[model samples]
Target: MLNQFLDNISLPAATVTSATAEVQYWKEDLGGIGTVRAVNGVEVTTEAQGVISAIHFKSGQYVQKGDLLAEIFAEPEKAQLQVLDAELRLARRNYVRIKALLDRGVTTESDLDTARSTLDQVVANIEVQRARVDQRVIVAPFSGVLGIRQIDLGQNVSPGEAVVSLQQLDPIFVDFSLPEKNYATVKSGLPVILITDAFPGNSYRGKITAVDPQVDSASRNFLIQATLKNPKQHLRPGMFAQVSVQIDAQRKVLVIPRTALIFAPYGVAVFVLEPDENGDQMIAAKRFVKTGEERGDLVEITQGLLEGDIVASSGLLKLRNGESAIINNQNQPPENANPKPGNS
Candidate 1:
């Protein structure tokens, strides 16, 4: 009879373990490798067919727009221009003489008109020859570094043939790709962090300048381009880069320790401690919480429990709804649970 009475009064030693839930911020990092390249690259070419009489600029030299890069032999075009100039002078003299004669009634109206037409033709020819001379001199179209010269001093080059390569190094571009799933999260003007093996311990910050509208069919990733201001010219073309994009900042949500939750076939649940009628404590039940995104060591509980709830973190797996629990004051419960009436 004594054993039976004790058994009826004794509760199972609650396998109690302490836990506290708090709010925390979480971040997810995604990684991708990319290649650095110039935002503008072009093959510098000659605009007219001629012999390269003089190379004005050396290879690997920085040049500004309209700076002479190479000079072609324009002697033939210049000689033609001289002949046209002489012809134009002669036409002007004839036109003047013809007008004087017409005023003096010595020449007909048709004679004066013919002389005027000849003068106009000569002027047009002179302009065409001048344009040909201008084409023989090759100039830089934009500010950039020139590549190796392809022709020697006396090498004959045809029109439209590549003379060298030029690239704008400052404000270089880094092209990378990200999964199509993150397409909506990434957009123009978002910040990016770039690192490369070539420049150890250095990181370049830039913004997304462009995002491809279409996702690649094979990889299902979209190409993204970032314009990094290389004011120091440290970033070089073709260098590999590791890129990170900062999507957005999210407010920290209420998080619980991962061990606090019990997963069941029906739903996920946690045990809440509440006072029973005898001033003892028992495990109250809160069931079926919806979970949000999880970060390291903690999970966001979206529903079913408030921030201040005293949850049985460790012994939840062995808990039952309305089961009796011993309030061992070994550890204080979370302060948020003990609400002041005004504060609550």
Candidate 2:
């Protein structure tokens, strides 16, 4: 009965059509979720140790560079400055008097020189004291939003102590990693599409700004940073994100429905259909092909096939090379006939 069925069965002929060739660049996605962080974040601190005499700005306030955020107790330094001013005035008076006396030959040039030196030393001391007093106050280093205040008014803070944190939020960074195998494909300035669970239906576009030169030994992945412009400050730091880097678009390539290729022990092969003499259609030949990569329902044919070759999309297993076939071009299969698991 099986032999009779095989004898009655006839192979179907596929119409020959020219296909445009494309060169597709494919990449494997290594899953890693990262947050949107500022490219520059720093804590502003006082340069000199002093008690916070006054806090000028509240927590979470936006501040500009050189804006006064806090002021330390500078009363002692003010008092010292006043004393130095008095000393400088007295030294200048003595120097003037000595210069006049020396010019009139009433005193030695040595006395005039000593008085000038005294005035210079007192002026230098005043400048030194002024610098020391200026160090008591803390100011914002850049224009950014200030974090929560770490010290309260009247609280003593040591040098290098954190007064508040500042972060530039206008432009943020989406940092992620890709496997070492994909390192060659990722380059600076490539466009990246960013998606986050925090904000659904909204996608932020960015470009690759940096790529780590060395691969991580432990994870065997290379680090990449993409800069995303956040004008509205909607995206915050530590927000989980999904990033897609577009390497390049595939131009033109000879592709077939992925289901058309039959995998066998010998090699991957596809049945091509052609018309024989006397207007009879048949599976003209079985050609072994080398497939490069697959995308969606299409597979690229790198070799063993021409542009106009037609291949069987269904019922390929029962057909053999040179078997007689009937031409059935109608009832075409769907565009994406070969559906894989988990692929929509």
Candidate 3:
């Protein structure tokens, strides 16, 4: 009766695809939130307290270094400059006349010295007047884009009062912070990838330019700066950014397709191929695996999976433990694990 019952029971094979868990290159990325800033930025301010005389640059204008932006009340200083120039010329003429007379034994040495002293005093006065006149003019310290105009014509601006904001947007800086544990891993020149809400679905590439020497005691994180090229000026200062730093070079690791994973209430598992009792046919053996970072279609298997071990890539819903499997590699999915959508 037992032999007759066993003869009536038939075993069926399940068709599935299998992939070898081989060593593939993997990179460890450290992620952090950052803010965009200009490499050189400043609030243009007045050094001299005077009424504005003329405005040269418009709001949101691109200016070159040393370009005049505005001018204060300089009429008084300019008039003093003219008086100093006349006095210097008159003193110089008197000095030359006195020196000629002394050479002819007609004028004393004291007279020549007095004329030379007068000429020197006038030259010094001219230099002081020139400096006073320059103080009224506001010039851009560096080449950059200007912000909104803060002062109007005939407005009295005091010293240290903000006039405008100047920022060099090209080759901008991104400042981010990393944990203290990753201190040794991060350094200058590491490649960085940035994304901001201002420009969605786009990535900006840059490299680490500076790393803070000390870590913050409160947060135990250190600051790092990366330089990104902004030729189009799409990235503005003070914008929020998400940053990823590739800490190390790509190294080989055991990897498998993500479709192979079976989600269970207990843990994640996968079906691996094993030999049957006769050693001729392959059977599915459920394996609980520890997973690491995931890159698109591929996942890093940290435990319970070895290199060269074949695992099921698809058709996992119907598979059972110790069940017969038929691997078909011809109809496998594309192996491109990580596909960049909007990155250049």
Candidate 4:
């Protein structure tokens, strides 16, 4: 009789947190590693070879378009310009005197013409001299933040030598590549998100601005460009980034919290709660599941789960198949499909 009583003994209910399987729209995420690029970036170079005389801006300085950046030694050119100016003034006076003489019949028209030609020649020479002087000055090509000073004052720089780098940071661009198979799905106006290790836990939102018409021959990947607002100017060119884009139409799928699933060598399973034969207690029943894609804290259930099914989200290890479970959700926080743990 004691052995029979022992066989009929019942175990207490196990406490577990529960989550409900929900039906929601799901989209496919396509992603690739990319590099951040400035919308407008260049190495500010010099056109004239000469020794630097003055550097008007500091390193990493913000400048407007046409702002003076540096100047090359041009004392000789300035002196030459002054001499040309004096010669032009003299030629103008001679031209005026010859014209008056011609009008009074004191000189021939040929003399007046010769004086006029001299005045025109001097004016042209002065203009050429001014242009020569302008070549020695270096100005910003566009409004941007300047990089370090490449050439010091009094240092000689060759023509086409980089003086500094200028980059426009607002509305930056990010270049990425995707497999050519996805070319038809990607185009201008598609939304993209970018994440970088430089700024942890932060993401940038933007849209596709351009897509290469042809795929790369070697890699079979097509190039894609995206534009993002960078008002703080934090994103720098050449920074490594991970970019993702959602493609295809949204479809309805059953979503559940990842904690609810139990993974074994055979397959995945979940503890689904059901009303016991007594009708007053709940029982945990083991059910095999077929999972699809996972995004953030949520997992997609392709099969074995129905909408509004209550499953064990926590305390899975503490419960056995057919074990009784106590519903204790007071400690279980709400489930979020896309959870930002840092914010929490």
Candidate 5:
């Protein structure tokens, strides 16, 4: 009866042997939200106004350079070419006959010169007509995938009107911005990785291809572009991505398990262990600590903690200031602070 009463009155000894803090390497990485875009994207347009007689490319089809995409009505230009060709043949024969007569002393120099001038004039006119005819046929400027067509067959298209969109997909671009404070760390050739919701568990590796020299005065941030090889072409334009870059190779930091932290309305703190006044027992002391980056199961402690300090990793609420703590090493938590849900 006496032991049961004492146990009920006294504070139950909390399980204090489960958790620990260790000094480890904490790498500092910079990350920002970004957008994925095609390396070469353009809205294809027409230079000549006419009815779209035919569309040679299907929507989303891959086309090669110089492949015909569409054709505008060019009956007038074709007929003009035919007329010019006939005129050119006549002029060529006349020039040859005049030259032969001049050599034989049968034709005057002025007549031969007129014939030669007529031949050259016809040739120039033919070239101009051929150019007009070529403009009626729209061809792909580069190898790429064609987007949906804006104009349909038999539709009258105006000059400079967008007909379709083309985008190169073999390699893609990712555009992201970083704060001006990181300008010194970011540069062309720096490695980066991108994560997107479309592919949850995959990461695409890339390298910084360009960085804006001038920072935006309003935001104090500069833009950077990265090139990623998309052999599988899984990535597409306008996709939101999370960009990550390692700013420091090795960053020495003091880290503790996340379970050691005690969050409250006032501030964040932790329970640290120190020797009691009698030096015969250890007591839990509430220490207010300033934290920085958090990763997995570990968090960075920038202040109010030492590298080898002993802290209460769990049951922080039960352990308060001046509370006696029994340091039992049996069944301690894993040294790796990183959480592995798969292990559960």
Candidate 6:
């Protein structure tokens, strides 16, 4: 009964956190969703169908162009080559003998011509057989990092079957699109920044490499592609990324921490703190404000607040107009224009 009577005459002081309004120059950014892609991507396949005799490359191996990747059984093709070689040697000897006899006028010229023709035919047959053997050997078409191996030694595979995936990781491409209204704002050479959930707190920088010449009729959006350096291959294909580009020059803005704003149905307001007569306790005065754009943890105040003005950042429910405030700022909320949140 005594405590209630004392509270009616003079209310108890409320503890609250405080933050100061400031002017900061920041540029507005154009943001969009993007997808990471490899510069060169393909499923490596063999041209000939046969049993896998030798697996030259392991899974996830980095290979260069023309490097031996795998091999198919070609014992029969190899035997054909050996027989062709022996026949070629015999044909050469017979052609030489016929030429010598014709020069001595001991044999007819027609016999020499026939021998020469026989030698040419055998040489052609050997070339054709060698080409068949080459089709069995699988080699890398380009330099890239290989994916998981699909087949093992002695596992028969058909032609055009994928053995593994190959992708050139360095200098990867990021594909995104913007609305047609922004088509005039974006162009080549503009800087691009990308962030992904896979690697928080890390941002990749690049420049716009290409812009689609025309917008899609269905979506009414134009595609934008940028090239990012990925020497370590940290960025991979099919990764979702958040892309941003600075659209215009920086502009100054008056901002306060979002926590300072008192959200109400009628309007948004804040408790502006002013020194009382005693110069010890602060008087919190409620002032309605007009807000503009919002940054990470800060909100812009277009009206009703002056720069360098102190505002209540916490304890809004307890704060009342004309009430005294004990500014306890030791435990303040996060107040930053740009915040990087972790998955906690």
RMSD of each: 9.5, 6.8, 5.6, 5.6, 4.4, 5.6
In order of listing, the candidates' clash counts read 0, 5, 0, 0, 0, 0
lDDT of 3 by residue, 1-344 (tens): 99999977756878898888989877778999999999999999998989998999998999999999999998888998999999988999999999999999998999999999999999998998899888899999999999999999999999999999999999999999999999999989999999998888889999999999999999999999999999999889999999999876776778898889998899999999987899877899999999988877788899999899999999998788978888888899655567655663
Regions more than 4 Å wrong, model 2: 1-35, 181-184, 217-220, 251-344
lDDT of 4: 0.91
Residue by residue across 157-258, what tens digits does model 4's lDDT show?
899999999999988999999998898888899899899988888899999999988999999999999999998877899999999986757878898888
| Model 2 lDDT per residue over 176-285, tens place | 98889888888899888888877777888889899999999999988999999999887777788988887665445667777778898989988777657766455457
Compose the digit string of candidate 5's lDDT tens values, residues 310-332: 98876666775767787776655
Question: Can you give the lDDT of residue 203 in candidate 3?
Answer: 93
Please, what are the lDDT tens digits per residue for candidate 6 over residues 77-103? 999999999999999999999899998
Q: lDDT, candidate 1, residue 233?
A: 86
Clashes of 5: 0
Top candidate by TM-score = 5
lDDT value, candidate 5, whole model: 0.86
Backbone clash pairs for candidate 5 read none
The whole-model lDDT of each prediction reads: 0.81, 0.79, 0.92, 0.91, 0.86, 0.92
> Residue 134 in model 4: shift from native, Å?
5.0
lDDT of 5 at 90: 100
Candidate 1 lDDT, tens digit per residue, 80-126? 99999999989999999999999999989999999999999999999
TM-score of 4: 0.72
Task: Give the C-alpha miss distance for residue 319 in model 2, angstroms.
Answer: 19
TM-score, structure 2 vs. true? 0.63
Error of 4 at 318 (Å): 2.2
Task: Return the TM-score for each candidate structure.
Answer: 0.64, 0.63, 0.72, 0.72, 0.84, 0.73
